[model samples]
Target: MKNQSNMPLYQLFVHPKDLRELKKDIWDDDPVPAVMKVNQKRLDIDIAYRGSHIRDFKKKSYHISFYQPKTFRGAREIHLNAEYKDPSMMRNKLSLDFFSELGTLSPKAEFVFLKVNGKNEGVYLELESVDEFYLAKRKLADGAVFYAVDDDANFSLMSDLERETKTSLEHGYEKKTGTEEDDFYLQDMIFKINTVPKAQFKSEVTKHMDIDKYLRWLAGIVFTSNYDGFVHNYALYRNSETGLFEVIPWDYDATWGRDIHGERMAADYVRIQGFNTLTARILDEPDFRRSYKHLLEETLQSLFTIEYMKPKIMAMYEQIRPFVLMDPYKKNDIERFDREPDVICEYIIKRADYLKSELDLLS
Candidate 1:
């Protein structure tokens, strides 16, 4: 593997037989045993192909879980995203960092190069998985984490698939950690979101969710124009101390002036008021709507600007440019990749202008 760049290198040693089995069924969720060497230290791990459609790409993403008594930077699990559709390969990291800066809980990410059996796999984004270790790292109290696996996680009484009433409120979520009682906490939140009386909705829903945190997360998605983020590309954490559910961003590579297919998207693609049942209900109340408008206005003035974001974008772009140029998978799009910093900056300018005009509509 090339070492011209300063990005950390992770080497995975998978037995030929295990590699074949893992390749035999790309859709399989079960992990195959593998060994990872980093900083000259080898650790036993279980690795599985991750993602819904990206699994079919020539370059694949991976989910790695460390064995007992072994941890990677205090994390038992981590996600290595190929970011195949994104030429810049920095949107996910940028968006998450932006959320964290906005005082919202978001996953921590970094750029790293990977090699399998000593063959270069190019640049991959290493993301901190939102699980038990995540809570422990932040010194957050014990809680339940649920992943919104599909569009059905829309927090609606209606199903996104059938367009009819859902059979279960928990249709689209996968319980990551928590007791059986935790399930009821999520179900009850959904039930109240859809069935609560509008006059009493604000008082009731606020009791079950951290409205301020949710609105901040909503602003992140809106400012970044992540169309898919409102519905399913997030995780719900039920804080035991506060007993409120909070949203955390996930799978945001399709954002920042690009759609899921990596095509350029208009700056105004996602509206100031994002989609989904929970967001709609939250914004329906006068006080909450005002709060959201204020949040968006504040972010627009301070954080969501070319002045604030360009340096960060350029820093990541320059740091990864050398490595991306050497990547066989991204070689064809080096020219496009080189132009991504400008593309993202232009998007931020236009998106900010558009949101400023729409802020009045919230009132």
Candidate 2:
């Protein structure tokens, strides 16, 4: 019913069309140039399809990056998420806010409407992209190497796996910064994690990793029940100045009582201890286990409670409701959208209770 008439000029690709496709089999087109608009002002940006399963769906998510101005609002790139699975469209925003409130390095998010070449693509979440620009904004050193983990990044020692050829360091990780050395920075640490004596794992690992931040990050994942985040949907980086690895949150649309494919998970989806190889082994350490318990208890008492979270959810609902009702590409209708906040509200109440019980059993 709408026409996307004019395309902007940043449609150039240094690489050939076939080579630049997101995957060899799919998406052979170059990034389309579009003027990203909010209200009436325009942002000069190039847009491309983002994500695996979501890309295949009719309601698509996108990656927005700059060409000329090269940076917009202090970000080199941005993400325009369909928020397709989330009926309430508050899961990722809520998760990020929860992490930020705890003083973690979380991405800044805003809800915006995307008018592609003046055609309404519907209301979407505009998120600050993770890059050198993001690290710089937080005053992190320029040389900090950023790597993204996804479903394939099992955190297992790739060296131990039986493969025909040598694997690239960039296999599971999507590298962001251009490190001068092509050597795999994280492989040794990963190998040591699985091979080291259980007694020494905690101490040895903490030397190269920010164990405290990792634990808090784990606590956030468990508290939110972000089932997919344990393996993927996270960014890992070794601070250039500090040389210690840190975890960064990503893709929370699958969180808050849901799975990657938009299926409803049990409210207590991720309560168990052995979620991932790396973090689970650390949690087995007595001191770390105790710290995790304290963190969860503190969260349940202060951050994760329904009384504290409900109002935030309600606030987000208020802002997005009008756009949701008007969104032509939204997966669900306004009535269904209206129904989710109440359901998510109840899920939060139940989830907090379930996590408390799980923590007690562990203690």
Best by lDDT: 1
Per-residue lDDT of 1-363 in model 1, one digit per residue for the tens?
336657998999999999999999999999999999899888999999999999999999999999844787899999999999998999999999999999899999999998999888989999999998999999999999999999999989999988999999999999989989999999999998889889889889988999999999999999988998987899999999999999999989999999999999999999999999889888988899999999998898899988889999999998999888767799779999999999999999999989998998899
For candidate 2, the lDDT comes to 0.71
- TM, every model: 0.98, 0.86
* 10 residues in a row with least lDDT, candidate 1: 1-10
Which lDDT tens digits does candidate 2 get at residues 119-230?
Answer: 4567677778777888889888665455555544556655224442326544567777746452355766666776889988888888777887888888878877787777
TM accuracy, model 2: 0.86
Clashes of 2: 0
Please list all clashing residue pairs in model 2, or write none if there are none.
none
Q: Give the poorly placed runs of model 2, Cα more than 4 Å off.
A: 1-26, 37-43, 158-170, 178-183
Task: State each model's CA lDDT, in order.
Answer: 0.92, 0.71
